[model samples]
Target: MKALFVAGTGTDLGKTHVACALLAAARSRGLTVEAFKPVVSGFDPHAPDDSDPARLARALGRPEAWAEVSPRRYRAPLAPNLAARLEGDTLRMDDLVADCRDWLSTRDVELALIEGAGGVMSPMTDEATNLDLMAALGLPVLLVAGSYLGTASHLLTALEVVRARGLTIAAIVVSENLDAPDLDQTLALLRAFEQQAPILSAPRAATWDADALVDTLLA
Candidate 1:
């Protein structure tokens, strides 16, 4: 199946937003899509719908078991590994990979989008990070970043590291952040620095140019 991993430079940096947009766009184009948050922290059992996986479920329109969307969940709003440890539970990279692969391998899923929990370097398990999981899955990454200050440094750093591992960066989506710099300048800087992958701007509270963004990836 055609798949993309929505990876962020850091947490809450618009991974889910981009993924949801793409999911909606792809569905509009008559393609079957499935998404997985896989391992999520900061889960509140009381408000189950207030979580990332639920957002994904809403976008996909497949309301079934939450575990199918997110196998490992922790209540503490911390890194998955730390949260898992606090509950005396372990998160194995093998298990994480298996869950995502199973979702991708489903025959009816024409496209799969796996959303990462934290930044690329964030630990998913005590021994492995999001990067390791990406490497294991070997899916093209649609790296997500924010248009806030210091984003250039973080985006460039993430781009370099993902490239260093010989992984294909499908594209970079710079989501608008509160108190961000000039959006045009940020996009220009990113394009000048990295010509290989297209950079798509995701403005906050504005209509997204979903057509171009989805077409680029589906290309």
Candidate 2:
């Protein structure tokens, strides 16, 4: 399966939202696609179901098999390695890679959307960061940037970092977070960048039309 890692400039930048849109888009267009958010942290013990994987499962209409998609989950509202360490669990890179392979083997998926946690530099383990993991996977990245006032600089910075690391960028998605309705400036900046890849806008989470999202990503 061809895997696409959806990374972001920072946390809560609609990485999962974009990922689900990609998954639903591909699936709706008759492409066999699966979503995976490997090694998620920041789980509330009292509310066990509020994890990234769980949210993804609900978004993609695969609520029954949430565990099958994402196996490594941890409590503590921190990075995976730190959170895992707190829960007496060791987060190993090899194990995560193996789990990803195993999950992909089940289906002849056209695209595997691997959504990384936090920014590219966020640590998943003591030894490696999320960017390291993405590089190891050898997949083209789709950088998701939140469309706020300072999004242009954020996108450029993120693009430079990814380019410096020699990561292949498949595309850039500018997602509108918060409650802002004015996207003219953000949209114009993205257009001004004139990056090789396409830059698409994702409106507010609740108003996001999944069908349009799918069409654009797959188109």
TM-score of each: 0.95, 0.88
Top model number, TM-score = 1
Model 2 spans with C-alpha error above 4 angstroms: 45-49, 179-181, 210-216
What's the C-alpha lDDT at position 210 in model 2? 61
Tens-place lDDT per residue, model 1, 94-147, is: 999998887777747777889999999999998999999999989999999999
Q: Each prediction's Cα lDDT score?
A: 0.87, 0.77
**What are the RMSD figures for all models against the true structure?**
1.4, 2.2
Candidate 1 structure lDDT: 0.87
Q: Residue 56: error of model 1 in Å?
A: 0.5
Error of 1 at 58 (Å): 0.6
Cα lDDT, model 2, residue 58: 67
For model 2, name the residue pairs that clash.
Answer: 25-214
